[model samples]
Target chain A: MKILVGIKRVVDYNVRVRVLPDGSGVDIDGVKMSINPFDEIALEEALRIKEAGKAAEVIVISCGTDECQQQLRTALAMGADRAIQVKTGSALQPLSTAQALLRVIEREQPGLVILGKQAIDDDNSQTGQMLAALWNRPQATFASKLVFEGEKLTVTREVDAGLETIEVDLPAVVTVDLRLNEPRFVKLPDIMKAKRKPLDVIPLEELGASLASNLDITRYAAPPLRQKGIRVENAAQLVQELKNRGLL
Target chain B: MSKILIVAEHDGHTLNLSTAKCVSCAKAIGGDIDIAVLGQGHDAVGAQAAALAGVSRVLMISAAHLAHPLAANWAPEVLQLAANYTHVIGPSTTMGKDLMPRVAALVGVNQFSDVMEVLSPLSFRRPIYAGNAIIDVKAAEGQKIVMTVRTASWPATGSGGNAVVEQRTAQGTAAGHSRYLALNSAGSERPDLQGASKVVSGGRALGSAEGFALIYRLADKLGAGVGASRAAVDAGYVPSDMQVGQTGKIIAPDLYLAFGISGAIQHITGIKDSRTIVAVNKDAEAPIFEIADIGLVGDLFTVIPEIEALLG
Candidate 1:
């Protein structure tokens, strides 16, 4: 069985993102970029599945500008057997990205697919489910725990209500949540080895998937700022303040 | 003119408050709003939906497999009803996030998630970068729109107008590939975190799981819900469900209390909408103080017990 993992490059999670003054998008000028934290977790899970002998091959796929190949190489360093880059400069929305991934899924014919439940940048949480729908396969999302049994996969999801367990057949899509696993640190030796790994760059247009973006981002703005209040001397003052505000 | 269908989130007994919030979002979009209640033996939930102020009608869908709100079964059903409506909306809850994208894909439309403001029938404003920035977006014309409303951003519609309820069955069958096994939820008597008017959250400073007992005690005394920063949850002090951050539950409570939390931007995004925030951290320069309405520069170990005693 083969596992395909989707990785995305985004502004580092620690950076304070600022909207461009002209209301275009976030300013990423000179800022550090890293593989989306969740995507790393997904890739880590794929590596684990491969290490357990449940998967024969682990392939990492990323869609972005040529710059994204850096993140792909990092995935390869982390232990993905190979890397594929869908070259496109435009920001692909979840649906369009799913379509491109669907094309890859068809060509690769992987037994399982794994992706982050949502990207930290867009926070859409859509691609995995959309890909499953496009592929007409079962989807287990927000997976915190996964177990394989014969041809069936059991996934425990962390949902709004609580944890819900579900069973899905093979050839399914699983989107990982934060608690899934701690991604391993890429070693210096592995980084050198990753450079030798085969990386195939395919133009996004060559995939023959419709890349139309249905949602148009019109403008960007900062959220309303919360005004800071005065510091209290002690618990007595804190209680008094709450009582004065009728919050107690 | 647009016709909207809202997929109501409900347990078997009653509708979740998020459904009413979605109704508010739908009403703002200027549409003939109808709600589809899909569950087994949930007629009471349908009744609640009909009583929502702006709902014009309620479509009741009862299927044995839908009793637990599985996405594989619900998506196809939503896609079936979506053909008659121009927009299909659901709350950005666990069920909505799980189900709506599949419906959007099957219907060949892109999903707009966590819609905060309905700019027009076709445009919306949503938070990106974990609420660090907001993006205004417009859906392409001539395509049916599928979106999930950020329940925290919209107020629940009041009950007044009476909408007619109609029972309808979906033509699609449940996908046998996925099956529900069990749910392990923390049972609580206090208000749910998302809907809570007041919340008491702890951070990594709490140190250990046993330390969360103080947080619960404080929350119980205040009649508030309990929450935790991702740091606390990651440290094994609480379950993932208790995590309060951008990736966790986004809450807008009337009063928020933080103990030993050095506010990270991700955690701040979740609580920025809070009416009044109070922080107790020995480190006076903790980022939480920047947004806190009342900051107490003291050790939580001492401050929390003192406040609890004072309140008692």
Candidate 2:
């Protein structure tokens, strides 16, 4: 069985994001970019599954501009056998993105597809579920733990109530949560070897998928600020302030 | 002139407060609002939803398959009910996050998640970079709008409505590909993290899994909920459910107490809406002290016990 992992390039999680002064969007000029943290976890899990001899190959796929190739190379270095870049300069909405992935899924016919539960940039945890719905297959989302049992995959999900375990048949989609696994670092030798691996670029239009954003982002702004308050001396002073404000 | 339909979140026994908070968001949009309660033996939950102010009607869908909230099983019923309404809304809780997108996909509409403000009937403001940046978005006209309200941003709707409750049968068969096996939930008698009026959070400074006992004990004394910073949760000091940070649960309590927390920006994002914040850390320069209303430069191990004793 082959495993397909969807990766996305986003601003590094550690970088403090700033909305542009023009109210267009967050400033990404000269800012560091990397594989979305959760997507990295998904790719890591796929590589582990392949390394365990449960899968034959792990294919990494990304949908973005030409610059996304940098992240795909990083995935290749991390241990993905091959990479597919869905070349698109425009920002694709979740549905359009899923539709494009569906076209690839039909052609690739991987036994399993793994994606990040949400992208930190958009914070929209919709792609995996949308892909599952469009594919007309079962989806196990927010998977914290996954175990393969022949054609069946058992996924433990992080739900609002707590952890819930579910079983889905093969040819299913699973969106990974943070606790799945810690991604491994890419060594220098692996980076050199990854440069020799196959990286194919497919244009978004070539996939014959309808790409349209149903939602239009009008403007961007920084969130309302919370003022820093005065520091008190000790617990006694803290209690006094709470009592003064009738919060105790 | 828009009619809204909200899917209620419940555990078959009690209605989750996030549903009322979603109703508050829907009310702000100025609409004829109705709620859909989907689960087996959910009459009590349906009644609870019907009682929330601003609800015009409640459609209670009693189905055995819905006993566990699975997206594939719930999406069909929601899509069927969504035909009559112009907007569909749900709480951005785990269940809603898992289920709403599927409903939107089936209805062929894009879902707006974590909606913090309703700018217009179709426009909304939502936090994008984990609450660091806010974006104003508008759904295209001539399409049904699907959205999930960020519960922390909206107040819970009051209980004064007298809406009628209607019973409805499940429309489609359960998607048989996936099956619910089990749920290992952390059973706690303390108030829920999101609904708690006061929260006491611990950080990595509390070294081990056994170290969380101090936080729990202090929370019990104050009648507050126990929370943990992402560092503490990652260090295996507590369950992931107790984590309060950008990637964890966002909470807006009346008072927030931090013990040995350095207050990373990700963690502070969750508590920015909190009314009052108090930090107790040995390091005087910890970032948590920056936003703290009262900062105590002391060890949590020594300060917590003293505060507990004083309260007693």
Candidate 3:
């Protein structure tokens, strides 16, 4: 069994994103880029699965410009055996990205496919399920815990209500959530070795995935800022202020 | 005018409030709104959904496989009904986040997520970058639209109407190797955190699980919902469901009170939609004060008890 995981290059979660002045998109020219945090968790889980000898290999894949390979190398440094990049020039939406992944799944036929629940940059939270739907496979999303049992997997999912546990067969999609496991730090030697690892680049068109989008992101703007409030001396003053506003 | 179909969220018994909120969002678009309630023996849930105002009809789709809201089993049911409506919508809760995208993929359309504002039936404003930036999304004409309504942005539609309920059986059995296990719901007596109008949240400053009880006491006294920062939940002080943040539950309450929470950007995104935010932290430099409608630089231990005494 081989584990396939997604590695997306996104604006680091720590950066305070700034919208472009032209209402086109965010300004990412000089921004620090890194692996989507949830994808890092997915890669960490895939690595653990391979290390346990339950899986024969771990393959990390990404789609986008040439820059995406940088993040794939980072995944390789973190212990992915190989990397694949779906080279595409246009910014891919969830629909196109899922379609591209389906093309890959048909060719690779990995037993388990893992991806981040969402990318912080888009915050869409749609790609994994979309991929599963297109691939006609069961999806276990927002998984906090994964237990392998022969052909079936028992996954603990973090939901709005609480923790929900479910079971799914192999040849499925699992989108990891936070609290899965801490990602390992890449060693200097591993970074040097990752350069020699097999990194395959496939054009989006060669895979027969369309790059069209029916939904257009027309404009971008900053969110309204919250006005700062005044300070109070103690709890007494706070209570009085709340009473004045009729909030208490 | 748009014809909208909302996939209802329920747990066998009561309907999740998110369904009603989706009704509110659909009303903004001025549509012939219908709800699809999928569960076995969920007549009660159907009746509850029928009670929401502005709902034209309720589609009761019952099957043994759909008793649990697994996306794989439920997506096909929604797809069967997809061709009848221009828009297929659901709440942006975990269930909808997991289910709607699959429906979109089956429909071959990109989902419009977290629709904060409706420009037209075809165009919407949604948040990206964890609410730091907003983008206007427009769907092409003649294309089916799949969307997840951000419930926090819209108030629940008032219930008084009597919409007609139409019953139907599930189309196909998709018991394809996936099985439902158990749901450890945070069966707390506290008001449902996402639906509550008043929220009281604490942070890592509460050193132990016992220290976190102060938040519960205050919440109970004020009849508010209790929440915690990721720091508190990660520290094992509270359940993860109690976490309020971009990753957790994004909430909009009438009033929000924070105790000792430093307010990371992720946490702020969850509560920034709140009507009135008040923060109390002993450290004067806590970032929570930046967005708070009222700020108090004081010890939460002292101020909490003091406020409780004053309330009494």
Write the residue-wise lDDT of candidate 2 on A137-236 in tens digits: 9999999999999999999998867889999998899999889999999999999999999999999999976755469999999888667687776667
Scanning candidate 3 chain B in windows of ten residues, the lowest lDDT window is B169-178
What's the distance in Å from true for residue B135, model 2? 0.5
- Candidate 1 per-residue lDDT, tens place, B23-72, comes to 88998899799999999999999999999998899999998888878888
Error of 3 at B235 (Å): 0.9
Per-residue lDDT value at A222 in model 3: 96
- Return the lDDT, model 3, position B43: 97
The list of candidate 3 runs beyond 4 A from truth reads none
TM-score of chain B of each: 0.97, 0.97, 0.99
Q: What is candidate 2's lDDT per residue for B1-312, written digit by digit as tens? A: 989999999988899999999998998888899999999987899889888988999999988888888898898899999999999999998899999999988888778999999999989999998888999999877679998899889999999998999998889888888888998889899999999999999999999889889999999998999999989989999888888877788888999999989999989988888888989999988988878877889988988887887776
Query: Chain A alone, TM-score for each of the models?
Result: 0.97, 0.97, 0.98
A112 Cα displacement, candidate 1 (Å): 0.8
Candidate 1 displacement at residue A133 in angstroms: 0.5
Q: Which pairs in model 1 have colliding backbones?
A: none
Model 1: number of clashes?
A: 0
Of the candidates numbered 1 and 2, which has the greater lDDT value?
1
Show where candidate 1 strays beyond 4 Å. none
> Candidate 3 on B40-60: residue-level lDDT in tens?
998999999999998999999
lDDT of 1 at A5: 97
Worst 10 residues of 2 chain A by lDDT: A208-217
